[model samples]
Target: MTDMPPLILWFRRDLRLADNPMLAEAAQTGCPLLPVFVLDPETESLGAAARWRLGEALVAFSQALAAKGLRLHLARGAAGEVLERLARATGASGLWWGRLYDAPAVARDSAVKARLRGLGIEAKSFPGHLLHEPFGIQTSGGGGYRVFTPFWNAIRARDPGPARPGPARLRGWDGDPGAGERLADWRLGQAMRRGAAVVARHALIGETAARDRLHDFLHGPVADYPARRDRLDRRACSGLSEPLAWGEIGPREIWHAARSVMEGAQDPGVDSGSDSGAAAFLRQLGWRDFAWHLLYHFPQMGARNWRAEWDAFPWRGDSAEAEAWRRGRTGEPVVDAAMRELYATGRMHNRARMIVASYLTKHLLTDWRLGLDWFADCLTDWDPAANALNWQWVAGSGPDAAPFFRIFNPQSQAQKFDPEGRYRDHWLKGVGADDFYAAAPLRWRLDPAAPPPVPLIGLAEGRARALAAWNAGKA
Candidate 1:
């Protein structure tokens, strides 16, 4: 090992080494690098699916490092304490990590940085997780972008540099790199129960898989992404959510690769936006950036309504109805199918997510938090900023929120989006019609011949009730 004090590359959400600004920075110092991942308190608090998938990713990450003649050390405890201990034991000089934006993470990182600095250690954070840091972009007024379009435009105005390549080798670790707890002992995957079996069939793990998936999508799916993304039955969207959430890939890599694809597709005669599908898909990524923008500005936005006035809006606390929603027995085909899809795969199509969130908040009149918490527990791709912002957006209680009065009629949504009812046919296969009606109120079971299931509340009735509650809250 080199006599120079090594730099500790602390791994968190930014898991991949490629396009990793910190790793690249640390490599330049020619100091040995010690990579470590800690299952700290905040990480422990992650919802079930998130934790399980994280454990799986950690193993993949370690292997990826090993292929390059390095080992990812694992430890468990408070991150600051664990890092301090590791730094002492490993003789590390400085620390580097990709930055995180959520409130809890900000607090944790701030404290750790301060502690390390006081001890004559250098602690630095870099950008890899997002192209534009949440707080970095601002409107002309120097405030967070509450509206997404302007946010996208403003960020686009700035020149985000080209993406960097992955490091060749990380030379460090005088002792055993696997000197911490065994991954199996963590038992993170055990949280999934039966859901694990279902999600495993669809999961794409690690950096290579992420890159391959992106390549495959750009080759074909991006050709039709603009019109096909909303089709729940179609695989037109980049199913990169899980990997993106776990930081197996970074946004800059995605952004540049997409730009390159579009540019390559353009012969001199073709316009830049000719690949409308790729452009539209990239806009969705902008939405992810928008989510962080809101969260960074309003840290409390996750657990509470962003439009605080909505706090007075009456939310029905019906455990039975909410339970039915959770179980995918709500008697609404589209809504039920979406919930079942989420349960079975720990993922829901974006359109399905909007429909169910709307149904939960507007039709059933439950708190958005209920649905948000449930998604947090179950979604393999569950992102804190995306999930929170979206739930609140659909609930009409977020920045630039959808109108609360614009309640989605599930049957109509299913007809329009899942025209053939293919989504329902797939997810609702084993679920009988009568089984759905059993969860509904007795009066709702009016059409036995039409379909065995009937809605728990009529759409018209639900709309009227929701509007009255909204008007009352405003008054």
Candidate 2:
């Protein structure tokens, strides 16, 4: 073993190697690299689905590191303490890591940096999780942009540069690394009730798999994205959200892929379709960037409304109706199908997400936080900034939020999007296959063997009530 002190690379959400900024920069330093991952409180507290996904991702990442002749040392406890102990034990010279946007993460990372600097061990953080650092963006007035259009326009216009390639091979610290906890002991999956078995089958892990999926979409399905992104019955989406959230893939990589298609670069992955489709799909990464932008500037959005005036807006506290909404028992075919899809596969279509969020916040008059937490528990791709921001956007409580006066009629939404009950037939078990095809032109074709759940509240009544509350608050 070499006597030289190693530079520690602490893995957090940015789990993958390729396109990882911290890994790339550290490799350039030519220091012996020691890889470590800490399962601290914030990580430990993730909802069941997220925890389950993280566990699977870690297993894949560990194997990926092993292939590079490296080990991802796992430790449990406060991250600062764990890193300090590990550094002292190993005679490490410094620590390097990627940044996280959430309030808790920022606090923890700041504290860790200060402590390490105090000890004269270098600690540096890099940007790998997002195309732009949340704090780096600002308006002409030097304040955060509360509007998304301008935010997107500004970020989209600026170049993010290319993603750095992962090291061809890593020089792992040739030292006596101490015992770190086995991944199995974490039990991140056991907290889940629907059984992580289902989510595991659905999740696509590892960086290579994520990159291949991006390439496949750029080649074939992306051309249809503009015309059919909201079609619930079709496979027009990239399905890269979870990997993006887990940092298995970077946004710059996806941005580059879509930009390549837009630029007329022909590859095996590009289908004969419109470049406009590729350009439209690239907006998703922009939205992800805007989510973090909002979170960093308005951290209170985590538990409160972005528009504080809406705080007094009445919401149904805890009730059987809310429980039904959460369980896919709301008797609304589109909403039920979406919730069930989330529970069974750990994901739902993007269109379905908006529909279900509308049903919970406006139709049932439930608080947006309930829907947000349930999603956090059920979605493999659960991202703090996006999930919170989107839930509030649908609830009419966030920046550039949908107007409270506007409500999605699930019946009409499914009709316009699902059209032929194709998506409903596959997911909604309430109706007999025959009845579903034969039912009225729109939703609820199924003759649920069990009586279709009665509507928790009449949509008209709920909509009217929500409007009254919102109007009163405004008045």
Candidate 3:
């Protein structure tokens, strides 16, 4: 409505068209907008697999937008520099985007905001990623909570409001690009050579697909989530992590959808079973929020252990044990399957994640950071906060930390949760053998072996060695 041309909606992590507060607010201005995605090369440093997933998400977003008469303007270089040039070329008055809490994102955003203001271009960030902003939830004494239960309790007591979907239509603005690497030229998936094919085989990306997946999970597995969530082989959990991580789906949307079913009952006068599944699923979302809170309050959490005592813990540095864990050859089927599954599909079941994390840290006595880095490189759904938080949890160094002695016995875990060996055989079969490297994804292929290497230390011995290392480090 104002004389200012539409603000450029600089798309980042919040990629979807629905339940996006920033996009909704920006659209209310009636300004013609430039939807832009900056493919900064710095992202390349994260991992080729991560970049590959990101590129696919973007391409899906671009195609969806194009169908609706809007095309995503892809650009590359430092974010600030790219935005400045974009502003100059498009004659745009401002930039707007959903906020991200990761350290790298925080650094880039701070610099970009200052530079945009300096250039007389308005820039604003909105809390479209997490339900409550990172700084929103805190303790009674006005400090961060270092434990999960208390932190989660604090969050549970609060209310996350209704979801806001994006505007149905936009009077899209034409924009000039200063520079951009062609999507194909970026070749984010070149390392895998079959990256897109791999992702397509398992996970589906994009708004509509995410919504459908959420609905499917709700109608079935969600009802039993509290009991079955940790089951590695069962479709016991929502496969929503990839979408949620990429912001292809927002927590707000998921929250409300699950709540609707849970709140509905044949007898409205009293509470019913409806709230159970919703409550359980919401708890996971709470954990996700808590992870972000930890990262925000303790910025060092992304890289350092939450517990200072654990800092003294000696960790195996890329040793054979570490290598064995990576190949799922730790003589632990559950752990190996998890690692192998991560390699094959760029994801792992939540239970599998914890199981493998425990094997790496408490069982193998390797640094949690090593496992976290590998996940960051390979996981299609890797969230900086969630990934780091969970790793530290298993290492007995995070908020509401797992006790060091609580090691996961992988065989028992598999027998209990994956009793049928369905998950194990699925991944193992995919690679032709338990240790077949020839057919394995290149990411999992270590040291040029014909078949993938098999397990080294038996489960019991690995556990003993890992615990001994922890005790030694403590002493």
RMSD of each: 4.4, 5.0, 3.2
- lDDT per residue as tens, model 3, 154-184: 7664667668775788767754444556788
lDDT by residue for model 1 over 13-93, one digit each (tens)? 988878888888787777777888999989999888788889889989999888877778889999999988888776778
lDDT of 2 by residue, 5-117 (tens): 88999998898988888898888888888999999998989998899899989998999999988888999999999999999998898999999988999999999999999
Candidate with best TM-score: 2
Instruction: Output the better candidate (1/2) by lDDT.
Output: 2
Q: Name the lDDT value of residue 264 in candidate 2.
A: 80
Clashing residue pairs, backbone N/CA/C < 3 A, model 3 = 262-274, 328-336, 329-455, 435-452, 436-452, 437-452
Sorted by TM-score, highest first, which candidate order results? 2, 1, 3
lDDT (C-alpha) at residue 170 in model 2: 84
Query: Which consecutive 10 residues in model 3 have the weakest lDDT in total?
Result: 265-274
